[model samples]
Target: MSSARTVHLLRHGATVRPGLLLGHVAVAVTPQGIADCIRVAAGATFTQVVSSDLSRAAECAAALGAPVRHDARWRELDFGAWDGRDPTTLPSDALAAFWRDPDQAPPPDGERWSALIARVTAALADLPDATLVVTHGGALRAALASACGFDARQVWAFDLPCAAMVTLRIWPDSAQIVGLRT
Candidate 1:
């Protein structure tokens, strides 16, 4: 018999603003976001619940009444000087440069998408086959990109919504996206 694991990739609950490019910043979850988590976890069971160390993610895990294992590597990409900067504020050329190849054209001092992917991969390696990961949209995109064998640039197109859940079945050398937006 073949052994398989189910990984639940949950984007953290909603925040104060949707456009705030938050990276490593401590932000609180909106009340609705908390309720959304509860709604999602109503009768779900999992081997473990892990989350980014950020307060938003931790709080969501807490509301689920599970012992969350906080992992720094699961944190969102560090936006550095661009933290909290609205995307619309970026210069057109600069934005185009980043949109073209975010893995290389990083913000003034922000982390590259490749680094973020590596961190998330390492953090995920230790998880059991069946685990629940509460993280950010960027982290989820990274996982999707890795599973789909796509380049880092492809992750930019996966705009998952807040509090969304993405399911993946990972194997030794391959991974599959089973379901999304649960």
Candidate 2:
């Protein structure tokens, strides 16, 4: 009998500015972030490990163990001109509109919601069985939305704080969300 394959999606630890829009930025994970990753690593078992090419995710993946393969496909949504800006700095109306309809109102030059979901779904589909994917919050949300039948707006509602984890059992025929681990 074939065993069910488990995929663990872990959000990277805290960034320099937790509230900033850090899409595609190579921000270093904080010391506390490293500690949180170490703590998570201590309790879990993974057959394979992968991470986004971004520094924060990569560093967290490394903390889980060695042989971490970084993939740009797993990177967070590229915010383009808004990459490192604080959301508070943007016009409230524009920000609200973007949040309400991300696919239609993408950040200037940034990736659209549909594109992000497609890329992240493809990346997850290509992973090995029992894999651990260390990535950004946006990437994790995209995966959740794809695998768990969540809508774009509902994906944003998920509070995937730093170092949070969500597990899914994926099979050839279907996928089941195991649970979220804070």
For residues 1-182, write the lDDT of model 1, one tens digit per residue: 44667788888889977787888888899999988877775544587899899988889988888788998888988888878889888777876787688777887789998898888888877779778888988888887876667776666666677888888888867788887764
Instruction: Report the Cα lDDT for candidate 1.
Output: 0.81
Residue range with the least summed lDDT across 10 consecutive positions in model 2: 37-46
List TM-score per model, in order.
0.92, 0.94
Candidate 2, residues 138-164: lDDT per residue as tens digits? 889898888777898888887889998
Per-model CA lDDT versus the true structure: 0.81, 0.86
Residue 86 Cα positional deviation in candidate 2, in Å, after optimal superposition = 0.9
Weakest lDDT window of 10 consecutive positions for candidate 1: 37-46
Please list all clashing residue pairs in model 2, or write none if there are none.
none
Best by TM-score: 2
